[model samples]
Target: MQNASKITEERINKGSLLALAPIGVFLVLFMGSGIITGDFYKMPALIAFMVAAGVALMINPKESLQNKIDIFCKSAGDPNILIMVIIFLLAGAFGSVAKAMGAVDSTVNLSLSILPANLLVTGLFLVVCFISISMGTSVGTVSALTPIGIGISQKTGIPLELLVAIIVGGAMVGDNLSMISDTTIAAANTQGCELKDKVKMNFFVVLPAAIISIIIVAIMTSGYQSASTETYSYEIIKVIPYLAVLVGALAGANVFVLLAGGVLFAGAVGLFTNSIDLWGFIGAVSEGMAGMQELCILVMIVGGVIGLIKHNGGIDFVLNYITSKIKSATGAKIGIALLSSIIDLCTANNTITIITAGPLAKEIGEEYDLDPRKIASILDIFASCWQGMIPYGAQILTAVGIAGVSSVAVIKYLHYPIFLLIFGIISITVDFSALKKKKTH
Candidate 1:
C-alpha cells in the first residue's frame, strides 16, 4: 500500500518553462527585427507566426515527427480558429464591397453632418459600445467600425492607428459588459451566478471608467473643432449598406450571415451607382478574400502554436503558480484578475481565457467568501482589458489587420482599456462599495 501511494504521488505534470520558447522566439524575431529596421510592420505578422510555429513544432522532440505534425494540424483545425477565419473572410468581403459602393465614406460624412468634429471620437466610441453590447462580440464590433474609423481618419487627417485604438476600446466596453458575451457567460457559469446579476454588478464598476474614457477622448480631440476644412458630398442612398449592416448586427443577426448580407446589399447599390457590375463585384470579393489571407494565416498558426503550448502544460504551470500565491480576500481578487490576465496573454482569446481561469477563480472566491458577482466581473473585465491591450490578441490583431498598421501604434492610444483596468484594480483594492451587496446564496 505504501509503495502504490508513492507511485501515485510521483505523477508528473507535462508542463515545462521551455514550452514558452516559441512565443519568446516570435517576439524577438518579429519585434527585434522591427526595432532594428525602424519600421514595425515591415516584417509581416504572418512571417513571425510562421517562424514561431516552426519553433513550437521542434520543441516537442520526444513526440514522433508525425505525431507532432498531427497536433499542429488538429490545432489549426480547431473550431474557434475556423470560425474566426470565416469571419475574417466575410468581414473582408463586406468591407471591400461596401467601400466600393461608397458606404464607408457615406457613413463617415453622415456622422460628420450630425456631430461636431470634436465629438467624432466620442460619438464613435459610444456607437461601438452600444453595438457591441447588443451583439456581444468584440471582433464583430471592430470589423464593422474599423473601416468607418479609417475613413474618418482619412477625411479628418487623424492618425489611423489612434482611430483603430479608439474603436477597440469601445469594443472592449461592450465585451466586458454585455449580457451575452462569452466572457460573461464563462465567468457567470463557473462562479455559479446569474448572468443578469453579473451584468448589474459590473455596470456599477465599469460605468465610471467609461465616463473617464469619454472625457479623455473629448479633451484629446478638442483641437479638431477649429480644423474642420473638409466637406462631404455623400449620397444618402449609398449609406444604406452600412446602415443595414449595423442594424442587422444590433438585431443579433448571425455575424457571418450579417456580413454576407451587407456584401450583397453593397453589390446591389454598386450596380445601381455604376460603382461596380457583376464582374467588378466578383472581383471585389476575390480581392477582399485575398486581403484577409495574411490575417487568416496568422490566426491559424497562432491557434496551433498556442494549442501546443497548452497541450505541453505551459498554461497549466502558469495557472498553478498564480493560484499558489493567494493569502487574503484582496489577494484572491487580484489573483483572479492576474490569473485571467495571464491566461489571456497565453491564449490570445478572451473567451477561452475566461473558461480556463473561471473555475480556479471560483474556488479562490469561495475560499475567501468573495462575492460571486465580483469574481465574475473581475474575470470578464480583466480578460477584456488584457485582450484589448495585447498586441497579438485577437481584438487588437483584427483592428491592426483592418487598419494596416503595427499593433504597437494602436496600443498607445487605448484609453478605455487602460482606464478600465485601473478602475478594476481600484474597485477591488480601494473600494469594495460597488461589490458591497453580499453574494446572496
Candidate 2:
C-alpha cells in the first residue's frame, strides 16, 4: 500500500528531458531489439533491465554512484514491490500444488462433464476464464490450461491454434480484472482506488465484452463435437480448493490470506487423499516458489529501474508530455488508455505496463477530475487488450510456443481483448452518470 516517493515542488516544475532516457533505453533494448531480432525472448529480460538501471545511474550523476545504487535498492524494496513479490510466490505455490494434486484436472473434467460435446469450445473458454479469474495470473492460466486444451484439441480434431486463442482470450479476462492480478493491483494502488471499487466499475464494461466473446465462441464452434474422451470422472474433493480460490477472491478476502489458505487447503486435500506425502507437499511448495524466480527477478529489477527513473525526474517528464494534449475528461481518459496500451505494447508485459503507466494515468485523471476507479479500469483494460493483440507479445508467444504453432495463428482469435477495447471506447464516449455532468457544470 506504499505510495510512490513524493517529488518536491521545484523538481516537478523543472522536469528534465534527460530523466526520460532511461525508460527509452529500456524500451529500445527490450522491445525494439526484439522486433529486429525476430525473437522476443532472445534478450534476457533481467539483463536488459539491469542495463537500463545502470543508465539511470549514469545519467543522474548528481548523486554519488554509491548513493544512486542505494536509491535503486530502496525502491526495489518498497513495501508495495515486496507485497507484489510475495503474492507471486503464494500464487505460484498454490498453482503448482493444486495441479500436482489433480485440482486442475478435477476442475477441467467437471466442467467438461456438464456440457455436451458440441459446446466443448465455449465451455473450455469459460472454464479457463474461471480458472484464470480464480488463479489471478494469465501466465499461470496459460501453463495450466494449454495442455488440457491440447489434449482436447488432439481428440476432437479441433485446431490447436483455435483452442489456444480461446484460452488466451479467457486468460485476458483475469489478467485485466482479477482481484489479485498485478495489472489490477498496479492500477488500483497508483490511482488511489480500492480493489473492490475498481472491480465494481470495471465489470460494467468488461462483462458485456466477455458475454459477447462467449456467444461468439459458441456460435463459431456450434457443430464441433469434442471426441468421446471429453467425459471423464473427477473426485469431488479435488475441486474444493479451486472453488475456495474463486469464492475467496469474489468475497473480497485479502489476496495474501486467500492464496495462503488455498495452498494449505490444497496440501491438506492432497494429504488426506494420499496423493502426496508430507515431504511431497513441501517439495511442491518449494517447486512453486522456484517457478516464481524469473518473475521475481524481473519485478525487483524493474522496481529498481523505475525508482532511479523517478528519482531523476523521468516520470515527471513523461507525465508532462502525456498530459500536455489532454484538454477534456474524454481526452484525458483516452490519453490514459492509449498511454497504457502503448507502453504495454512496448513492454510486452501487461503488468509491467500497468506499473509504469499507473502513476502517470493517476496524475492525468486527477488533473481532469476523471474518476480514479474508471482510470484503474482503463489502465487494466487497455494494457491487457494491447498485450493480447501483439503477436510477438509474451502471452501470445508463450501460448503459441506451448501449442506448437505460430503466434500469428492465435493472435487473430483473441476476441476478449478486442471486444474489451470496443466496450472501453463506448464507456468513455458516453458518460451516462450524473456525476460527470455535475463535474462539468
Candidate 3:
C-alpha cells in the first residue's frame, strides 16, 4: 500500500512539473538561443511560447489533446493578461510617437545642456530614482529619462550603456521600495500588512543601497568633460505631455488613462506647433500601437501559460517542497527569499512575483516570529534585484535594445544593482546586526 501511495505521489509531482514546462521552453528556445546567437530579439518570444505550450499538452496524460488546447486558451485569455497587453500597446505607441516627434532628442539635449557636466551621471541617476520612487514604475521612469540619459552619455563622454545602467539601477530601487509601487501593493496585500509599514521597514534597507549607488556614480563621473553640441530649439509646450504623464501617473491615475491623456496632450501640442498635421498625428498613434503589438501578444501568451501552470498546481508543488524543508526560523526566511526570487525570475514581473510569493512568505513569517515588515522587504528587494539583472526581463531587455549592446555586456556594468543584492543578502543573513544594535541603544 505504501509503495502504491509513493507511486501516486510521484505521478502527481510529474504532472505538476509538466504544467511548468512553458517557462522552461521560453528560457531555452527564446532566451537561450538569443544568448547563443548574440541577439536577444532574434527569437520571437511568441514562437517559444507556441512550441513550449504545445509540449505542455503532450505532457498531460489525463486530458485529451483538445481539452489541453482549451485549457491553454482559457489561461491565455484572462483579464489581467489582457490588461497587460493593453498597457504594453499604449506604452509602445506613446514611446514611438514621442520619439518620432523629436520630443526625445529635444528633451535629451535640453537636460544635458542644463545640468553640469561633472554632475551629469549622478544627477540623471538621482532624477530617475526620484521619479520611479514617486511614480512607482520603472518602465515609466526609463521612458521619461532614457532620452536624457542617452544625451548625457554623448555630452559627458561617459559610456552610454553604463549611463543607462545607472538610470535603470536607480529606477529599480524605487520600484522595489516605493509605497505606491505595484510591487509594494502586491507585497502588502499578500502579506496583510499596511503599505506605509512595509515602506517604513523597506526604506531603511533600500536607502543605504540608494545612497551607495549615487556616491559610486558621482565618483565615477568626477572627471567628465562636456562636449559642445549644435543648439536645437523645441517648443516648451511639447514638454507638457511628459510632465502631464508623470503627474497623472504619480497621482494614482490608471496607466491606460495616463497614456491616453499623454497621447492627446502631445498630439495637440504637435498640431498647434505644426510639428504634425491632424492626420499625421493620427498616423503616428497607429504606428505606435503597431510597434508594440508584438510585445503585447507575448504578454498575453505568457500570462495564459502561467495561469494554467498555477491552476495545475505547479506553484503549489514548489511552495510545498520549500515549506517542507523549513527546519528553523533563519531557514524559513532564506527559503522565502529564494522562493520570491525564483518566482520573479519565472514571471519577469516583480509585482506578479510578489503577489504569488506574499501569502506563503507571510505564513512562514508567522511560524518563525519574523517581522512581516522584514518579510515584505525581502520580497521586494530580491524581486527587484532579479528583475534588474535578468537578461530576459523587461528592464534589462529595454536597456539592451536602447543601448545597442548585448544584455550580457550591460550586466557587467550594473555595479549598483549587483552590490544592492549583495548588501541585501548580507543584511538578512547577519540578522541585520548593525541595525539591531542601533535600535537597542
- For every candidate, C-alpha RMSD to the true structure in Å: 7.8, 4.4, 7.2
Alpha-carbon TM-score of each model against the true structure:
0.63, 0.88, 0.69
Model 2: ten consecutive residues of lowest lDDT: 1-10
Best by lDDT: 2
Task: Please give the lDDT score for candidate 3.
Answer: 0.68
Instruction: Summarize candidate 1's per-residue lDDT along 1-441 as a digit string, tens digits.
Output: 123223223323535777767767866765677568755456665687788888888886888877877888898887756766776677678767776677656655565566666687788788778656644568877887898788778777778888898899988877777644556655776677766667766786678888988888888776654255657567888877766765665466766677788789889999999878899899888887798787677667777877777677665554444445554578778888887887676556676566556656765675567788888889998888888898877788889988899899889999888888888888787654444566354
Q: Identify the superior model by TM-score, candidate 1 or candidate 3.
A: 3
Residue lDDT tens for model 3, 1-441: 123233335535433655667667766776577668766557765787768666666765776877767877886776655655665566556655665566655554455456565676787776677656654568766766766667767776788778778878987977765544667655665565555666666666676777888888778878886675546465566666666766665566766777777777778777787788888888888987897676556655655565566666665565445545655667777888897788777657676567556656775575556777678878988898888888877787777667676777777767666777887787576644233311211
Clash-forming residue pairs, model 1: none
Among the numbered candidates, top TM-score falls to: 2
Clashes of each: 0, 0, 2
Error of 3 at 46 (Å): 1.4
Off-target runs (Cα >4 Å) in candidate 1 are 1-14, 116-207, 216-231, 326-417, 424-441
lDDT over C-alpha atoms for residue 331 of model 1: 74
Q: What is the lDDT of candidate 1?
A: 0.73
lDDT of 3 at 68: 67
